[model samples]
Target: MSDSIFSIPIIAGTFLLAGVVKGVIGLGLPTVAMGLLGLVMPPVQAAALLLVPSLVTNLWQLLAGPRFGALLRRLRGMMLGIALGTVAGSGLIAGPATGAATTALGLALAAYAVVGLFGPALRVPPRAEPWAGPVLGAVTGVVTGATGVFVIPAVPYLAALGLARDDLVQALGLSFTVSTLALAAGLFWHDALPLQAAGASLLALVPALAGMALGGWLRARVRPGTFRLCFFLGLLALGGELAWRGLG
Candidate 1:
């Protein structure tokens, strides 16, 4: 990675864009940052940059809600799955092979976009929660470890659980927070995240927070569905490009 890409302007701009998406939709920061930064740096670096902002933002979101304990208990299966799966696959991502990590990230992004755009609505019955949660969590964990993206089946699965709007948002925050921590641990275990990268990630949080403030302001003025459409469309293009680079 070029040292120039870590310049304040570039890093702030990248995180600002990511933060806005996250503020507006309550997700997408990591996705946007990974896609854009990957153009200049390795996937591991991109993922490393995402750590602090993702953790801080999601923690705030999680604490704002009233159902933390309940949600934690309820999602225990999925949570455990995510932890184990992430541990299992994190090495693949933080490993020396940038090509493999990039390919995986690209595929994960594309898969997420396709599912967001065209996948069927998922519905899990109350009786099925026990088995379904862990399975989805495990998949999301592996994806997070391998690609540094942790939405996929996890978000959709949470949505399918039939929670109210506020609860769902809180739940998403909890999930992201946990996922970020797991990824951090995984990277550390592999010695992929050095002190400098961690420092950069922490510094990047400022712009991300700023962007989120702006996004929050826009949330009421702009239509979420419309912004979501634009977001996914952007992801589609970015993902395609990354996939091509990885494949090449």
Candidate 2:
């Protein structure tokens, strides 16, 4: 949506809400904002609007944790895969094939929701890391490049690493930060992200941060598992709608 007095408030409110969700659960800002905003605007525009806030917040989340070096060392392969895969898939945003892209994005989201809700959590043995890391990361990157959402095999893969809770949060942050940067580069190459939209995306960060602060305070008191359930359910519904939009 174009910047206007009315649209600006809506944009801010969407980011505020998405930020609160991210603050509580350590993810979902882009998923929530892009999914909801897509109803009124182009999904690519929604994805573009998410760029600055996504980068700033995710970087903040990554740096706030203690395992930056170790996580980097551990996930190096995956990170490399994400960067390359995102670039490879960048043409989807620039091409005229958006209908197919959105369909794939919807299916991916629905699959992610199913995995989160009912699937067993699997553990990856240390020995498998060499091969598994790049594969999962590349898949996650492809999904992010196509859909503007980054959680998929990546989240489950990271969780499988059996990190401590804080480490998992930081890992998500690290992955998301990489995904955000990669997505930005992809969009720029595709010419989908204009300079004016970038400026507005930067401005959207204020409300996002504010909502994050509020959510962080509430996180101490809320049951995250409950919120997680709601989050997935919401995603499932949104995914269904998006899929329908694409198929219809």
Candidate 3:
């Protein structure tokens, strides 16, 4: 979408809010930002606008800590899944299949939010199989590339792996960074990435970075259960809105 007078403030406010949430939670910038932006911009444009900021923030997250090598080794399979799924999803976005994918994304996000809120109590048996990470990562990659939804399928797998909270957050951040860059490239190849979209995405980096910082700080002080509750609720609301828009 072009930067019209009406869209400027909307874009700024969306990023600001998205930044704050990401700053507190270590993720959700794209989910929250794209959700809001979808109200004002086309779904594809909203997803595109989040590309630059998401890429930058994820790069920082991936590189920010000690034990990077160990973490990478542990999550390597998932990363591979992310790569495969991202390519598949991005290819789908180029055809007439986008609408069905978008609608499914909206519903998936909604289901994720609901399950995240209530299903943690019902733990699935943890799998020791090597294929788990790849499966989860691939699913996350597809959802992310197609609709900017990153938390589904992957979050449960991450949790199941018993990763330290910090590790989980960092891994997710890195995964998103890689997947978003790939998706953006795919969009560009398909002539979907315009200069205006790139500019807006770059501008959004400011708030996204700020929010990531804030979220990292907050993660320590907040109760994990409470934070999850609130975050999932936010997701639910966003997902519901998306579904409504799609159906309408």
| Best prediction by TM-score | 1
Scored by lDDT, model 3 comes in at: 0.74
Candidate order, lDDT descending:
1, 2, 3
Query: Tens digit of lDDT per residue, candidate 3, span 1-248?
Result: 86488887788778877777777767777777867776666667887888888888778877886667887887888888887787677755544554555565577678788877776643334465367778878888888667766677776666666667788777777677777877787677767778888988898787777766666777789886788788889778878877776776
Candidate 1 residue 167 Cα shift, in angstroms, is 0.7
Off by over 4 Å in 3: 94-102, 121-129, 213-227
**lDDT top scorer:** 1
Better of 2 and 3 by lDDT: 2
The sequence of per-residue lDDT tens digits that candidate 2 reaches over residues 105-183 is 6777788788888879799999999899999999888888887888888988999999999999999999999999999
TM-score for every candidate vs. truth?
A: 0.97, 0.95, 0.87
Pairs of residues at least 3 apart in sequence or in different chains that clash in candidate 2: none
- Which structure is stronger by TM-score: 1 or 2? 1
Estimate the TM-score for candidate 2.
0.95
Candidate 2 residue spans exceeding 4 A from truth: 1-6
| Candidate 2: count of backbone clashes, pairs at least 3 residues apart or interchain | 0
Clashing residue pairs in candidate 3 are 19-211, 23-211, 23-214, 23-215, 24-215
Q: Residue 6 lDDT in model 3?
A: 85
- The superposed Cα distance between candidate 2 and the true structure at residue 137, in angstroms, equals 0.8
lDDT of 1: 0.89
